[model samples]
Target: MNRKIIFTENAPGAIGYYSQAIASNGLVYTAGQIPLDPQTGEIVSSDFSEQVKQTLNNIESVLVASGTDLSKSIKLTVFITNLSNYPELNAVFKKQFDGIDPPARSVVEVSALPKDVSIEIDCIAAL
Candidate 1:
Protein backbone atom coordinates (compact mmCIF):
# COMPACT_ATOMS: atom_id res chain seq x y z
CA MET A 1 0.00 0.00 0.00
CA ASN A 2 1.48 3.32 -1.04
CA ARG A 3 1.30 6.10 1.55
CA LYS A 4 1.74 9.83 1.22
CA ILE A 5 2.52 12.38 3.89
CA ILE A 6 0.33 15.44 3.72
CA PHE A 7 1.42 18.94 4.61
CA THR A 8 0.08 22.42 4.09
CA GLU A 9 0.73 25.96 5.30
CA ASN A 10 -3.01 26.45 5.49
CA ALA A 11 -3.04 24.54 8.73
CA PRO A 12 -0.95 25.02 11.86
CA GLY A 13 2.55 23.66 11.39
CA ALA A 14 3.04 20.54 13.39
CA ILE A 15 5.05 21.22 16.53
CA GLY A 16 5.80 17.56 16.96
CA TYR A 17 7.14 14.83 14.77
CA TYR A 18 4.04 14.19 12.77
CA SER A 19 2.59 15.12 9.45
CA GLN A 20 -0.56 17.20 9.27
CA ALA A 21 -2.28 14.22 7.70
CA ILE A 22 -1.50 11.07 5.80
CA ALA A 23 -3.18 9.76 2.67
CA SER A 24 -3.01 6.08 1.85
CA ASN A 25 -5.09 2.99 1.33
CA GLY A 26 -8.00 5.11 0.17
CA LEU A 27 -8.12 7.05 3.43
CA VAL A 28 -6.78 10.22 4.90
CA TYR A 29 -6.07 10.41 8.60
CA THR A 30 -5.75 13.92 9.95
CA ALA A 31 -3.96 15.14 12.99
CA GLY A 32 -5.90 16.76 15.78
CA GLN A 33 -6.47 20.37 14.79
CA ILE A 34 -6.87 23.08 17.37
CA PRO A 35 -8.24 26.59 16.95
CA LEU A 36 -4.90 28.11 16.06
CA ASP A 37 -4.89 30.27 12.96
CA PRO A 38 -2.23 29.13 10.52
CA GLN A 39 -1.25 32.62 9.43
CA THR A 40 -1.03 34.12 12.88
CA GLY A 41 -0.12 30.85 14.55
CA GLU A 42 -2.29 31.84 17.48
CA ILE A 43 -5.53 30.63 18.83
CA VAL A 44 -8.09 32.61 16.86
CA SER A 45 -10.70 33.03 19.60
CA SER A 46 -11.16 31.98 23.15
CA ASP A 47 -14.90 31.55 22.78
CA PHE A 48 -15.95 27.97 22.27
CA SER A 49 -17.94 28.58 19.11
CA GLU A 50 -15.18 30.61 17.53
CA GLN A 51 -12.62 28.04 18.59
CA VAL A 52 -14.67 25.28 17.08
CA LYS A 53 -14.93 27.18 13.84
CA GLN A 54 -11.18 27.65 13.68
CA THR A 55 -10.55 24.02 14.40
CA LEU A 56 -12.91 22.91 11.68
CA ASN A 57 -11.27 25.29 9.28
CA ASN A 58 -7.92 23.76 10.06
CA ILE A 59 -9.35 20.32 9.48
CA GLU A 60 -10.64 21.42 6.10
CA SER A 61 -7.17 22.56 5.13
CA VAL A 62 -5.66 19.21 6.01
CA LEU A 63 -8.32 17.38 4.06
CA VAL A 64 -7.73 19.55 1.04
CA ALA A 65 -4.00 18.95 1.25
CA SER A 66 -4.62 15.24 1.18
CA GLY A 67 -6.77 15.53 -1.92
CA THR A 68 -9.94 15.06 0.02
CA ASP A 69 -12.71 17.18 1.58
CA LEU A 70 -15.07 17.20 4.48
CA SER A 71 -17.58 15.07 2.60
CA LYS A 72 -15.05 12.27 2.60
CA SER A 73 -14.66 12.31 6.37
CA ILE A 74 -15.90 9.09 7.89
CA LYS A 75 -15.41 9.85 11.57
CA LEU A 76 -14.43 12.68 13.87
CA THR A 77 -13.05 12.67 17.38
CA VAL A 78 -13.56 15.86 19.33
CA PHE A 79 -11.79 16.53 22.59
CA ILE A 80 -12.90 19.44 24.67
CA THR A 81 -11.67 20.89 27.88
CA ASN A 82 -15.19 21.23 29.16
CA LEU A 83 -18.32 19.32 28.37
CA SER A 84 -20.40 22.39 29.22
CA ASN A 85 -19.19 23.89 25.95
CA TYR A 86 -20.94 21.10 24.05
CA PRO A 87 -23.91 23.30 23.27
CA GLU A 88 -21.73 26.02 21.85
CA LEU A 89 -19.59 23.50 20.03
CA ASN A 90 -22.67 21.74 18.70
CA ALA A 91 -23.99 25.01 17.38
CA VAL A 92 -20.80 25.64 15.45
CA PHE A 93 -20.69 22.05 14.26
CA LYS A 94 -24.31 22.21 13.17
CA LYS A 95 -23.60 25.24 11.05
CA GLN A 96 -21.11 23.17 9.07
CA PHE A 97 -22.34 19.61 9.34
CA ASP A 98 -26.08 20.25 9.29
CA GLY A 99 -26.05 21.51 5.75
CA ILE A 100 -24.37 18.32 4.64
CA ASP A 101 -24.24 14.78 5.91
CA PRO A 102 -21.21 14.89 8.22
CA PRO A 103 -19.16 11.98 9.32
CA ALA A 104 -19.82 10.01 12.48
CA ARG A 105 -18.44 11.75 15.54
CA SER A 106 -17.43 11.17 19.12
CA VAL A 107 -16.91 13.99 21.57
CA VAL A 108 -15.16 13.77 24.91
CA GLU A 109 -14.15 16.12 27.67
CA VAL A 110 -10.50 16.15 28.53
CA SER A 111 -8.64 17.82 31.36
CA ALA A 112 -6.31 19.65 29.01
CA LEU A 113 -5.11 19.92 25.43
CA PRO A 114 -1.97 21.12 23.73
CA LYS A 115 -1.39 24.89 24.04
CA ASP A 116 -4.15 25.09 26.62
CA VAL A 117 -6.74 25.35 23.90
CA SER A 118 -10.33 24.54 24.70
CA ILE A 119 -10.91 22.11 21.89
CA GLU A 120 -9.21 19.75 19.47
CA ILE A 121 -10.47 17.63 16.62
CA ASP A 122 -9.13 14.77 14.48
CA CYS A 123 -10.70 12.65 11.79
CA ILE A 124 -10.51 9.76 9.39
CA ALA A 125 -11.51 10.58 5.82
CA ALA A 126 -11.77 8.63 2.60
CA LEU A 127 -9.73 9.92 -0.28
Candidate 2:
Protein backbone atom coordinates (compact mmCIF):
# COMPACT_ATOMS: atom_id res chain seq x y z
CA MET A 1 0.00 0.00 0.00
CA ASN A 2 1.22 3.49 -0.78
CA ARG A 3 1.54 5.88 2.16
CA LYS A 4 0.25 9.43 1.91
CA ILE A 5 1.69 12.32 3.91
CA ILE A 6 -0.81 14.31 5.92
CA PHE A 7 -0.53 17.98 6.81
CA THR A 8 -2.68 20.96 7.67
CA GLU A 9 -2.36 24.59 8.76
CA ASN A 10 -4.82 23.81 11.54
CA ALA A 11 -2.01 21.98 13.36
CA PRO A 12 1.60 22.78 14.08
CA GLY A 13 4.07 21.54 11.50
CA ALA A 14 6.58 18.89 12.44
CA ILE A 15 9.63 20.32 14.16
CA GLY A 16 12.24 18.04 12.62
CA TYR A 17 12.19 15.83 9.54
CA TYR A 18 8.75 14.35 9.85
CA SER A 19 5.32 14.82 8.39
CA GLN A 20 2.47 15.60 10.78
CA ALA A 21 0.94 12.23 9.94
CA ILE A 22 0.90 9.51 7.31
CA ALA A 23 -1.96 7.48 6.04
CA SER A 24 -1.02 3.97 5.02
CA ASN A 25 -3.06 0.90 4.35
CA GLY A 26 -6.22 1.50 6.37
CA LEU A 27 -4.77 3.60 9.18
CA VAL A 28 -3.46 7.07 9.80
CA TYR A 29 -0.42 7.32 12.08
CA THR A 30 0.14 10.75 13.55
CA ALA A 31 3.32 12.23 14.83
CA GLY A 32 3.29 13.17 18.49
CA GLN A 33 1.48 16.46 18.89
CA ILE A 34 2.51 18.98 21.52
CA PRO A 35 0.60 22.09 22.60
CA LEU A 36 2.29 24.37 20.11
CA ASP A 37 0.14 26.96 18.42
CA PRO A 38 -0.04 26.23 14.68
CA GLN A 39 0.29 29.88 13.71
CA THR A 40 3.24 30.83 15.93
CA GLY A 41 4.84 27.46 16.75
CA GLU A 42 4.75 28.35 20.45
CA ILE A 43 3.49 26.25 23.29
CA VAL A 44 -0.10 27.24 23.96
CA SER A 45 -0.11 27.42 27.75
CA SER A 46 1.90 26.69 30.87
CA ASP A 47 -1.02 24.91 32.53
CA PHE A 48 -1.01 21.14 32.14
CA SER A 49 -4.74 20.93 31.48
CA GLU A 50 -4.53 23.52 28.77
CA GLN A 51 -1.62 21.70 27.26
CA VAL A 52 -3.60 18.46 27.22
CA LYS A 53 -6.51 20.06 25.40
CA GLN A 54 -4.35 21.70 22.78
CA THR A 55 -2.44 18.51 22.16
CA LEU A 56 -5.67 16.66 21.52
CA ASN A 57 -6.90 19.41 19.28
CA ASN A 58 -3.71 19.25 17.28
CA ILE A 59 -4.10 15.50 16.83
CA GLU A 60 -7.68 16.03 15.71
CA SER A 61 -6.54 18.49 13.10
CA VAL A 62 -4.08 16.04 11.66
CA LEU A 63 -6.76 13.38 11.60
CA VAL A 64 -9.18 15.66 9.82
CA ALA A 65 -6.49 16.47 7.32
CA SER A 66 -6.25 12.77 6.66
CA GLY A 67 -10.01 12.53 6.01
CA THR A 68 -10.86 11.07 9.39
CA ASP A 69 -11.27 12.25 12.98
CA LEU A 70 -10.84 11.52 16.67
CA SER A 71 -13.89 9.29 16.61
CA LYS A 72 -12.06 7.09 14.14
CA SER A 73 -9.04 6.76 16.38
CA ILE A 74 -8.08 3.20 17.15
CA LYS A 75 -5.16 3.82 19.47
CA LEU A 76 -3.56 6.72 21.35
CA THR A 77 -0.24 7.13 23.10
CA VAL A 78 0.28 9.99 25.53
CA PHE A 79 3.56 11.37 26.80
CA ILE A 80 3.57 13.45 29.93
CA THR A 81 6.26 14.80 32.19
CA ASN A 82 4.28 13.97 35.35
CA LEU A 83 2.30 10.87 36.08
CA SER A 84 0.82 12.71 39.05
CA ASN A 85 -1.22 14.66 36.57
CA TYR A 86 -3.09 11.49 35.61
CA PRO A 87 -6.48 12.57 36.89
CA GLU A 88 -6.50 15.80 34.99
CA LEU A 89 -5.27 14.03 31.90
CA ASN A 90 -8.04 11.45 32.02
CA ALA A 91 -10.61 14.19 32.52
CA VAL A 92 -9.41 15.87 29.38
CA PHE A 93 -9.25 12.60 27.50
CA LYS A 94 -12.83 11.82 28.40
CA LYS A 95 -13.88 15.19 27.14
CA GLN A 96 -12.05 14.68 23.88
CA PHE A 97 -13.58 11.24 23.30
CA ASP A 98 -16.96 11.83 24.90
CA GLY A 99 -19.47 10.25 22.52
CA ILE A 100 -17.99 7.13 20.96
CA ASP A 101 -15.92 4.42 22.56
CA PRO A 102 -12.50 6.01 22.91
CA PRO A 103 -9.35 4.63 21.42
CA ALA A 104 -7.20 2.03 23.13
CA ARG A 105 -4.58 4.08 24.97
CA SER A 106 -1.25 4.09 26.71
CA VAL A 107 0.42 6.79 28.79
CA VAL A 108 4.11 7.16 29.27
CA GLU A 109 6.05 9.62 31.42
CA VAL A 110 9.01 11.14 29.68
CA SER A 111 11.96 13.05 31.09
CA ALA A 112 11.22 15.93 28.77
CA LEU A 113 9.38 16.98 25.62
CA PRO A 114 10.13 19.34 22.79
CA LYS A 115 9.56 22.97 23.85
CA ASP A 116 9.57 21.64 27.45
CA VAL A 117 5.80 21.32 27.21
CA SER A 118 3.88 19.20 29.70
CA ILE A 119 2.06 16.76 27.43
CA GLU A 120 2.10 15.22 23.97
CA ILE A 121 -0.22 12.82 22.19
CA ASP A 122 -0.09 10.71 19.06
CA CYS A 123 -2.62 8.35 17.64
CA ILE A 124 -3.51 5.76 15.04
CA ALA A 125 -6.83 6.28 13.34
CA ALA A 126 -8.96 4.36 10.86
CA LEU A 127 -9.44 5.91 7.45
Candidate 3:
Protein backbone atom coordinates (compact mmCIF):
# COMPACT_ATOMS: atom_id res chain seq x y z
CA MET A 1 0.00 0.00 0.00
CA ASN A 2 1.22 3.47 -0.83
CA ARG A 3 1.60 5.78 2.15
CA LYS A 4 2.34 9.44 2.62
CA ILE A 5 2.99 11.64 5.63
CA ILE A 6 0.77 14.68 5.88
CA PHE A 7 1.50 18.15 7.24
CA THR A 8 0.13 21.64 6.97
CA GLU A 9 0.80 25.16 8.23
CA ASN A 10 -2.87 25.50 8.89
CA ALA A 11 -2.62 23.14 11.86
CA PRO A 12 -0.45 23.00 14.94
CA GLY A 13 2.88 21.32 14.39
CA ALA A 14 3.45 17.96 15.97
CA ILE A 15 4.94 18.42 19.42
CA GLY A 16 6.39 14.90 19.44
CA TYR A 17 7.92 12.37 17.09
CA TYR A 18 4.93 11.93 14.83
CA SER A 19 3.53 13.34 11.66
CA GLN A 20 0.21 15.14 11.89
CA ALA A 21 -1.43 12.41 9.81
CA ILE A 22 -0.71 9.71 7.29
CA ALA A 23 -2.46 8.72 4.13
CA SER A 24 -2.31 5.13 2.98
CA ASN A 25 -4.35 3.38 0.33
CA GLY A 26 -7.44 5.58 0.24
CA LEU A 27 -7.66 6.60 3.85
CA VAL A 28 -6.01 9.14 6.08
CA TYR A 29 -5.34 8.52 9.77
CA THR A 30 -4.80 11.60 11.86
CA ALA A 31 -2.95 11.95 15.11
CA GLY A 32 -4.86 13.17 18.14
CA GLN A 33 -5.24 16.92 17.89
CA ILE A 34 -5.20 19.21 20.89
CA PRO A 35 -6.58 22.72 21.11
CA LEU A 36 -3.38 24.50 20.24
CA ASP A 37 -3.22 27.50 18.01
CA PRO A 38 -1.46 26.71 14.74
CA GLN A 39 0.61 29.87 14.72
CA THR A 40 1.21 30.24 18.42
CA GLY A 41 1.42 26.57 19.35
CA GLU A 42 -0.29 27.39 22.62
CA ILE A 43 -3.52 26.16 24.11
CA VAL A 44 -6.31 28.15 22.50
CA SER A 45 -8.58 28.49 25.49
CA SER A 46 -9.43 27.15 28.91
CA ASP A 47 -13.12 26.75 28.12
CA PHE A 48 -14.03 23.18 27.36
CA SER A 49 -16.29 24.08 24.43
CA GLU A 50 -13.66 26.30 22.86
CA GLN A 51 -11.04 23.63 23.26
CA VAL A 52 -13.26 21.10 21.51
CA LYS A 53 -13.82 23.45 18.63
CA GLN A 54 -10.10 24.16 18.23
CA THR A 55 -9.25 20.48 18.38
CA LEU A 56 -11.78 19.80 15.65
CA ASN A 57 -10.35 22.62 13.59
CA ASN A 58 -6.88 21.11 13.87
CA ILE A 59 -8.24 17.74 12.79
CA GLU A 60 -9.88 19.37 9.79
CA SER A 61 -6.54 20.88 8.77
CA VAL A 62 -4.82 17.52 8.86
CA LEU A 63 -7.62 15.96 6.86
CA VAL A 64 -7.41 18.68 4.25
CA ALA A 65 -3.66 18.17 3.96
CA SER A 66 -4.38 14.53 3.24
CA GLY A 67 -6.82 15.50 0.48
CA THR A 68 -10.02 14.90 2.43
CA ASP A 69 -12.31 16.85 4.69
CA LEU A 70 -14.38 16.39 7.83
CA SER A 71 -17.38 15.35 5.70
CA LYS A 72 -15.41 12.29 4.68
CA SER A 73 -14.55 11.22 8.19
CA ILE A 74 -15.14 7.52 8.75
CA LYS A 75 -14.49 7.31 12.45
CA LEU A 76 -13.42 9.49 15.33
CA THR A 77 -12.14 8.79 18.83
CA VAL A 78 -12.33 11.57 21.36
CA PHE A 79 -10.37 11.68 24.61
CA ILE A 80 -11.65 14.05 27.18
CA THR A 81 -10.63 14.67 30.76
CA ASN A 82 -14.20 15.10 31.91
CA LEU A 83 -17.32 13.21 30.96
CA SER A 84 -19.37 16.20 32.03
CA ASN A 85 -18.27 17.86 28.80
CA TYR A 86 -20.28 15.28 26.87
CA PRO A 87 -23.26 17.54 26.30
CA GLU A 88 -21.06 20.34 25.00
CA LEU A 89 -19.27 17.95 22.69
CA ASN A 90 -22.53 16.77 21.18
CA ALA A 91 -23.70 20.33 20.72
CA VAL A 92 -20.49 21.18 18.87
CA PHE A 93 -20.82 18.09 16.73
CA LYS A 94 -24.35 19.06 15.82
CA LYS A 95 -23.11 22.40 14.63
CA GLN A 96 -20.02 21.11 12.82
CA PHE A 97 -21.74 18.24 11.08
CA ASP A 98 -25.02 20.06 10.57
CA GLY A 99 -26.21 18.88 7.13
CA ILE A 100 -23.43 16.40 6.54
CA ASP A 101 -23.67 12.79 7.69
CA PRO A 102 -21.59 12.51 10.83
CA PRO A 103 -18.99 9.83 11.32
CA ALA A 104 -19.04 6.95 13.79
CA ARG A 105 -17.45 8.07 17.06
CA SER A 106 -16.43 7.06 20.54
CA VAL A 107 -15.91 9.46 23.42
CA VAL A 108 -13.59 8.27 26.13
CA GLU A 109 -13.18 10.06 29.44
CA VAL A 110 -9.66 9.86 30.74
CA SER A 111 -7.90 10.89 33.90
CA ALA A 112 -5.74 13.28 31.94
CA LEU A 113 -4.52 14.33 28.51
CA PRO A 114 -1.36 15.82 27.02
CA LYS A 115 -0.69 19.44 28.00
CA ASP A 116 -3.48 19.04 30.55
CA VAL A 117 -5.94 20.17 27.93
CA SER A 118 -9.57 19.21 28.39
CA ILE A 119 -9.85 17.31 25.11
CA GLU A 120 -8.18 15.71 22.13
CA ILE A 121 -9.52 14.13 18.96
CA ASP A 122 -8.30 11.92 16.17
CA CYS A 123 -9.96 10.69 13.01
CA ILE A 124 -9.88 8.40 10.02
CA ALA A 125 -11.22 9.61 6.71
CA ALA A 126 -11.35 8.61 3.10
CA LEU A 127 -9.08 10.57 0.85
Candidate 4:
Protein backbone atom coordinates (compact mmCIF):
# COMPACT_ATOMS: atom_id res chain seq x y z
CA MET A 1 0.00 0.00 0.00
CA ASN A 2 1.23 3.48 -0.82
CA ARG A 3 1.52 5.84 2.14
CA LYS A 4 2.71 9.34 2.75
CA ILE A 5 3.23 11.62 5.72
CA ILE A 6 1.20 14.82 5.67
CA PHE A 7 1.94 18.19 7.22
CA THR A 8 0.73 21.72 6.84
CA GLU A 9 1.64 25.18 8.07
CA ASN A 10 -2.01 26.04 8.45
CA ALA A 11 -2.25 23.76 11.47
CA PRO A 12 -0.21 23.60 14.62
CA GLY A 13 2.91 21.55 14.03
CA ALA A 14 2.85 18.30 15.90
CA ILE A 15 4.17 18.71 19.43
CA GLY A 16 5.34 15.15 19.87
CA TYR A 17 6.48 12.20 17.81
CA TYR A 18 3.74 12.24 15.21
CA SER A 19 2.96 13.78 11.89
CA GLN A 20 -0.15 15.90 11.51
CA ALA A 21 -1.73 13.32 9.23
CA ILE A 22 -0.97 10.39 6.99
CA ALA A 23 -2.35 9.32 3.64
CA SER A 24 -2.57 5.71 2.64
CA ASN A 25 -4.93 3.47 0.73
CA GLY A 26 -7.05 6.39 -0.40
CA LEU A 27 -7.62 7.57 3.14
CA VAL A 28 -6.28 10.29 5.32
CA TYR A 29 -5.81 9.75 9.03
CA THR A 30 -5.42 12.96 10.93
CA ALA A 31 -3.85 13.43 14.28
CA GLY A 32 -5.87 14.92 17.08
CA GLN A 33 -5.90 18.67 16.68
CA ILE A 34 -6.18 21.09 19.57
CA PRO A 35 -7.48 24.65 19.48
CA LEU A 36 -4.13 26.29 18.97
CA ASP A 37 -3.76 28.57 15.99
CA PRO A 38 -0.84 27.73 13.74
CA GLN A 39 0.24 31.28 13.01
CA THR A 40 -0.10 32.61 16.54
CA GLY A 41 0.57 29.37 18.37
CA GLU A 42 -2.16 30.37 20.80
CA ILE A 43 -5.32 28.79 22.02
CA VAL A 44 -7.59 31.45 20.56
CA SER A 45 -10.65 30.80 22.64
CA SER A 46 -11.86 29.76 26.06
CA ASP A 47 -15.50 29.53 25.14
CA PHE A 48 -16.40 25.94 24.33
CA SER A 49 -17.91 26.80 20.98
CA GLU A 50 -14.99 28.94 19.90
CA GLN A 51 -12.52 26.32 21.03
CA VAL A 52 -14.35 23.71 19.05
CA LYS A 53 -14.27 25.90 15.97
CA GLN A 54 -10.55 26.39 16.21
CA THR A 55 -9.96 22.69 16.74
CA LEU A 56 -12.08 21.80 13.73
CA ASN A 57 -10.25 24.35 11.64
CA ASN A 58 -7.00 22.76 12.65
CA ILE A 59 -8.32 19.36 11.68
CA GLU A 60 -9.43 20.75 8.34
CA SER A 61 -5.94 21.99 7.66
CA VAL A 62 -4.52 18.55 8.17
CA LEU A 63 -7.20 16.99 6.02
CA VAL A 64 -6.57 19.43 3.23
CA ALA A 65 -2.88 18.70 3.45
CA SER A 66 -3.74 15.11 2.86
CA GLY A 67 -5.83 16.03 -0.20
CA THR A 68 -9.31 15.71 1.19
CA ASP A 69 -12.10 17.74 2.75
CA LEU A 70 -14.74 17.45 5.45
CA SER A 71 -17.11 15.98 2.89
CA LYS A 72 -14.80 13.01 2.64
CA SER A 73 -14.62 12.37 6.33
CA ILE A 74 -15.61 8.86 7.32
CA LYS A 75 -15.05 9.12 11.05
CA LEU A 76 -14.21 11.55 13.78
CA THR A 77 -13.06 11.05 17.33
CA VAL A 78 -13.46 13.87 19.78
CA PHE A 79 -11.78 14.09 23.15
CA ILE A 80 -13.14 16.57 25.62
CA THR A 81 -12.05 17.56 29.05
CA ASN A 82 -15.62 17.94 30.30
CA LEU A 83 -18.81 16.16 29.39
CA SER A 84 -20.81 19.09 30.71
CA ASN A 85 -19.85 21.02 27.60
CA TYR A 86 -21.24 18.45 25.19
CA PRO A 87 -24.25 20.54 24.22
CA GLU A 88 -22.15 23.57 23.42
CA LEU A 89 -19.66 21.41 21.59
CA ASN A 90 -22.44 19.86 19.58
CA ALA A 91 -23.54 23.32 18.51
CA VAL A 92 -20.04 24.04 17.33
CA PHE A 93 -19.85 20.72 15.57
CA LYS A 94 -22.97 21.56 13.64
CA LYS A 95 -21.53 24.88 12.59
CA GLN A 96 -18.24 23.35 11.57
CA PHE A 97 -19.82 20.63 9.47
CA ASP A 98 -22.43 23.10 8.25
CA GLY A 99 -24.73 21.88 5.47
CA ILE A 100 -22.83 18.63 5.24
CA ASP A 101 -23.51 15.23 6.67
CA PRO A 102 -21.25 14.56 9.60
CA PRO A 103 -19.11 11.47 9.72
CA ALA A 104 -19.57 8.68 12.22
CA ARG A 105 -18.36 10.13 15.48
CA SER A 106 -17.27 9.21 18.96
CA VAL A 107 -17.04 11.61 21.83
CA VAL A 108 -15.16 10.86 24.99
CA GLU A 109 -14.18 12.77 28.09
CA VAL A 110 -10.52 12.48 28.78
CA SER A 111 -8.60 12.99 31.97
CA ALA A 112 -6.43 15.57 30.27
CA LEU A 113 -4.82 16.64 27.00
CA PRO A 114 -1.71 18.36 25.80
CA LYS A 115 -1.59 22.07 26.70
CA ASP A 116 -4.70 21.43 28.80
CA VAL A 117 -7.02 22.08 25.89
CA SER A 118 -10.72 21.65 26.46
CA ILE A 119 -11.20 19.69 23.23
CA GLU A 120 -9.38 17.86 20.49
CA ILE A 121 -10.48 16.24 17.24
CA ASP A 122 -9.03 13.53 15.07
CA CYS A 123 -10.45 12.46 11.73
CA ILE A 124 -10.36 9.81 9.06
CA ALA A 125 -11.11 10.87 5.53
CA ALA A 126 -11.52 9.02 2.26
CA LEU A 127 -9.58 10.65 -0.52
- Per TM-score, the best of the predicted structures is 3
Q: What is the lDDT of every predicted structure here?
A: 0.92, 0.94, 0.95, 0.91
| Candidate 3 stretches greater than 4 Å from native | none
lDDT of 2 by residue, 13-39 (tens): 889999999999999999999999999
lDDT, candidate 4, residue 33? 94
In model 4, where is the ten-residue run with the lowest total lDDT? 89-98
Clashes of each: 0, 0, 0, 0
Runs of candidate 2 with Cα error greater than 4 angstroms are none
Worst lDDT run of 10 residues, candidate 1, spans: 93-102
Instruction: State residue 30's C-alpha deviation in candidate 3, in Å.
Output: 0.2
Worst 10 residues of 3 by lDDT: 60-69
Q: Whole-model lDDT, candidate 2?
A: 0.94
Off by over 4 Å in 1: none
- Tens digits of per-residue lDDT for model 1, 44-122: 9888888999999999999998988988789999999999988998788888887689789999999999999999999
Model 3 Cα displacement at 99 (Å)?
0.2
For model 3, residues 52-73, the per-residue Cα lDDT tens digits are 9999999999998888999999
Count of backbone collisions within predicted model 2: 0
Candidate 1 TM-score versus the reference:
0.97
lDDT of 4: 0.91
Kindly provide the TM-score of model 2 when superposed on the true structure, using C-alpha atoms: 0.98
| Reference-based lDDT, residue 22, model 1 | 86
Write down the RMSD of candidate 4 (Cα, Å).
0.8
